[model samples]
Target: MTALGLVHPGHGAEDDYPRIEQLLGSDIRVDLVHTDLGEEPRRAEALRAAGLAERLTAGVEELRLAGAEAVVWASAGGSFSHGWEGAQQQVRDLARAAGMPASSTSFGFVHAVREVGARRVAVGTAYPPRVAELFADFLRAGGVEVVAVRDGGDPPADGVAGWGEERVLALARDADRPEAEAVLLPDTALHTVSCLPELEKELGKPVLTAAQVTVWEALRLVDRRVHAPRLGTLFTREPVVQV
Candidate 1:
């Protein structure tokens, strides 16, 4: 059984760990650590000042004590808020500090898209429209095209986690477009891990949600892939044909 360590930037969102466990089974242990991000609004400046590298290092040390093989920063907005280069550097710093493979959800979205072989994608988020646009910019900086993007804007401070599955999937459906090979919902706040199949069915494409890809990327960092049908196309076993 492989143990994975996750460092979340704020309180709450512990629901994600169990969701990952349900798909991958109880054998794969997930060690969770939360970092206090204060009560400040989750804007770019505030998020950059959150000092996740230091906090994440502590979490990594804790997970190492628990026998974790890899660690992941499970915040989508927090990492992307650092922009492309900064996000890369943040991950590098985390790996260096943790002495193990580390990743952030922002980069997880990119890696998931690349794994699915998509160059163009639609983004659906539970963030301010401007923040969602930042994600578009982030993807563009990574060489992936954003065909459509939409968001509810800043959701009254405490509103994102309370969003129901129907609401999240609606936002995803709205962002779905003809040119997009995948629809990306980039928020660790919303409870998305349970509705991946519903979202993928609604969008008629590979649907990548924040928590889903974060766990996937962490597994990928260690060269592991779990093929589960309920986890959507990304986790389905790739069929091999005779050459």
Candidate 2:
């Protein structure tokens, strides 16, 4: 079985691998290494000190040791905090260390948005407003337009992880706009896969979530572009949308 390495960029969501596995089905196995990023304060400080790159690199080698064929930094803000180019270099560094393809949830969001053919999108994030703004900027750099954004205001550590499905659904609903082609929820810490059908059904458009798209990005890196109709529009090879 092909193995996918998942690196928790320190938000303490250990259950991420199982969640990805569930969405990915039994064909692909996931090996995870969590780098223990501590509370939001410590996580933010690491971003400020530019410590996340080092941490992600460290975890990549760990996943390599576990025989993971590729790696994904599951936290979007971890890479996006460094801005667009910073996010690009972050994955490059990870791939260099792991000696395999690499990506971050941040980059995953960008690719996922493009996969859905969304030129304009609405973003809802659980990070502080500033961090949310950076993610939106990362998308713009990827050549997508962000029509609306909702910042959930930074909460304590595990704040996003603690959110129920209803909360995540609400955020997606709130982030949607008539002009937006898609709704983006950019936190891997949140549990999103179970309710993807309901979320998309309600919005009547694509709803891209972090964990879901991170898996999608991993598949792309490994050249496994199987369309997951159950996952959502992004996983399918269908045209994203016409500009």
Candidate that scores best on TM-score = 1
Model 1 Cα lDDT, one tens digit per residue, 193-215: 78888988887889998878888
TM-score of 2: 0.90
Q: How close is candidate 1 to the true structure, as a TM-score?
A: 0.92
Count of residue pairs whose backbone atoms collide, per candidate: 2, 3
Which residue runs of candidate 2 sit more than 4 Å off their true CA positions? 41-51, 154-158, 239-243
After superposition, the stretches of candidate 1 with alpha carbons farther than 4 Å from their true spots are 237-243
Clashing pairs in 2: 10-37, 116-240, 117-240
lDDT of 2: 0.77
lDDT of each: 0.80, 0.77
